[model samples]
Target: MSASSDRLPLIRLEALPAEVLVDLAAGRQPASLGRRCEEGALPPPEVAGRALRLLASGVAERWSLPYAMIDERGAIVGACGFKGAPCLGLVEIGYGVAPLRRGRGIAAAAVRLLLEEAVIRGGAHRVLARINPDNAASSRVADKLGFVRGEVALDDDGEPLAQWLWPPSTDFAHDGEAP
Candidate 1:
């Protein structure tokens, strides 16, 4: 069922354990969230599976860890985070929203939070949002955040994807961060 949502105050980035990730991936209401899953809050199997791989292969550091996107009402509406800790001062980011939660500025806001976290922790000098060429929505989110285009590269499975880079000096009109 669809739960109440406001575009909203701001989403909290909660660090979840691997077990909880598994639970969310399987469409279960993970106890860590302290609330029931919204209609599309749970991550699909594929997304959660990728996160597991990243966590294991990247030896997730605080800056590169996965996070649950908890809305103001405490329901998780998305999953967002870095692919792994920074390497050579660069890190990749990814985010996904629930079906019912898309088009509400949630992804953009989640991305902003990820960028802020990376900056705050001082673990990454450059943040990259690598997205499939066809993913226009993600491209818009990156653009909204002031990301500039970079060279395209293949992912782990050799799929070519566009790279959007966030320079260290990003201002992004940060008068207020809640989007």
Candidate 2:
């Protein structure tokens, strides 16, 4: 396991090379890096496809922006990161914890660490996360991290989604209001 000072265990996805991503997408773990393929450690097929497309298009500067969430024993428990680099000062963040690791605050810790990185190192002024309305656990993680719940909307596929923003703002009508 790589030594890190943060309380939560995380490794930036950018640290891994393209070959590692290809291996991960193929359900293989880079054992040399001490990575383990727990449930959900690798992105789903669709997400992986998009990542590959982004890589091929040369617009993937932030394609590897995610971090691998690790457990106390150094096994990857999940993944989290910005969808891409900050655009217009806003960055979208996403995370997923293995089913076995749910309810353990792993998502929250990973989000917090990413938030710190975005603001301090990436010059990001805002962070956003879109969650499915039925995803109560994800909502809880956002709430725990002080993300203000915004309007309810539909995603590209017409799925109900709730928009959450971090570093709570007072400008929006939903700001400072409880979800």
> Candidate 1 lDDT, tens digit per residue, 11-120?
77787678877775686766765675567656666666667777777665464346778887778787787777777887878888888888888888888888877876
User: Per-candidate TM vs. native?
Assistant: 0.75, 0.79
Alpha-carbon lDDT of model 1: 0.72
For candidate 2, what is the total of clashing residue pairs? 0
lDDT to native, each model? 0.72, 0.69
Per-residue C-alpha lDDT of model 2 across residues 73-95, encoded as one tens digit per residue? 66777777667667888888888
What is candidate 2's CA lDDT for residue 94?
A: 84
Clash pairs (backbone) in predicted model 1: none
